[model samples]
Target: MVSRRAFLRGLFGSFLAALAMLIGLPLSYKWRKRMSPTRHSMPETRSGAIPLPYPRIRGEMSLEEAIAYRRSIRDYLDEPITLEELAQVLWAAQGVTETRYGFRAAPSAGATYPLEVYVVVAPRGVVLPSHDFLEPGSYRYVPQSHSLLIVRQGDLQEPLYRAALEQEWVLNAPVNIVIAAVYERTTRRYGERGIRYVHMEVGHVGQNIYLQATALGLATVAVGAFVDEEVQRIIGAGPHVHPLYIMPLAKPLEPYRVSKEELIGYIESHRKERR
Candidate 1:
């Protein structure tokens, strides 16, 4: 007979498996390239790794300004994001800051650093200054080296967009950053409580990227609606790694504007509609 601890663990695992099957199967990619403006062809991986510039620690925009300017922007321009902009955003997300202590920009519980950052770069077929300096493919951000490790090269935006419920922004953005978490990193120390810590860490990472995007005048939105397994597959993440967030980065199509009265009116209108 199995011990009580083993029995509960098995039961919980079965519950999670059943929940995933119930939700994951129906939400599988049904819109694979079924929309307008076909995705760019797959990008070839570079044989050698490309080093990223040292992230600029100083910014013209103050932290308060960045926080105030932050917003969820979906529409993007056709221009490509330079490698420097990409590096800045990635660095803000999880780059090493305190080298001696091995700490990151975001605070990780016990410095377990469960989050893994993956960048999906697609520079081909885009009608902009060729950002061909870097290969078009999926790359994992190596925080220690401050460089990208090419996991898989090719235009992965198509599959990533599909996995993201066919969101246009996911496809249109020049780069998409996928964040995955390995719970075992945290759980070993805190047991079940470690799961909660991992999620909190992700939130910190997301806000950091959002603020950094604002400072750079770039656009990004946190995307949570996705099939976990599909996202894991798209980013070439293993089954043990859980995909937690997707942030597509690009230059905005137009300026951000809003009126106080217009906002209040919209909120009232939404209330009326709900009623």
Candidate 2:
């Protein structure tokens, strides 16, 4: 029943199948290994997600002190801010304060949070305790995980500065925090009125950032003048996400200190001149 031609043909088919497996198996293994997620991967591994240190609830500065010292600072020294400081500021902006209900630090209208926070880091902008620096890039803050997801790699300071109407502070500061809104998150529930709520929520978040920065002896100024479309592109935001604010943060070149009385006196002087 087995002819010599038939046996030769069967042997040839088996050899080809073996050769194919030898070629394909290694490639398949390599792909799977590359695609697999390592949950405990370190930042140096470039896994694209960086876990932030836990935020401290009790800072040295009291709430009143932070409020009193809060001022819009424009000039900054060339220096890198610590990752811990960055973490606290991000937490203040929108980190989840309650796990069970997923409530954020900033109050959302009807618990429908529409705000997204992003940070654009300059070269040598943020440093770890070991003195290693975070790669200069745009990172989107994930509130639930208290982590940063890399959006784009490489220095974006110049582009962001140009986008912000060539503000020197944007270029000079070590980091810039950009706040964007996804209106649908709120608008779906409250309709057009939700737009107003979203604005209010952003204001709250901005104030939180200001206070937190002040408490940490950091300086920041809320920058509103910029081309919206350019900023959205620089942050790699989706079409639905619209930028609302850009805050440049760094150590002040000189600390500005003023008492309430001094502020009142200056105001009075200006009022007298106007009259």
Candidate with best lDDT? 2
Error of 1 at 275 (Å): 25
The positional error of residue 201 in candidate 2, measured at the CA in angstroms, is 0.8
Q: State the lDDT of candidate 2 residue by residue for 133-200, as single tens digits.
A: 87687888878678886666678999999999999999999999999998987787679999999999
94-115 in candidate 1: lDDT tens per residue? Answer: 9989865457899987676789
TM-score of 2: 0.80
Candidate 2: where is the Cα deviation over 4 Å? Answer: 1-47, 260-275
The TM-score, computed over Cα atoms with residue i paired to residue i, of candidate 1 is: 0.75
lDDT of every model, 2 decimals = 0.78, 0.84
Candidate 1 clashing pairs, residues 3+ apart or interchain = 42-155, 43-154, 43-155
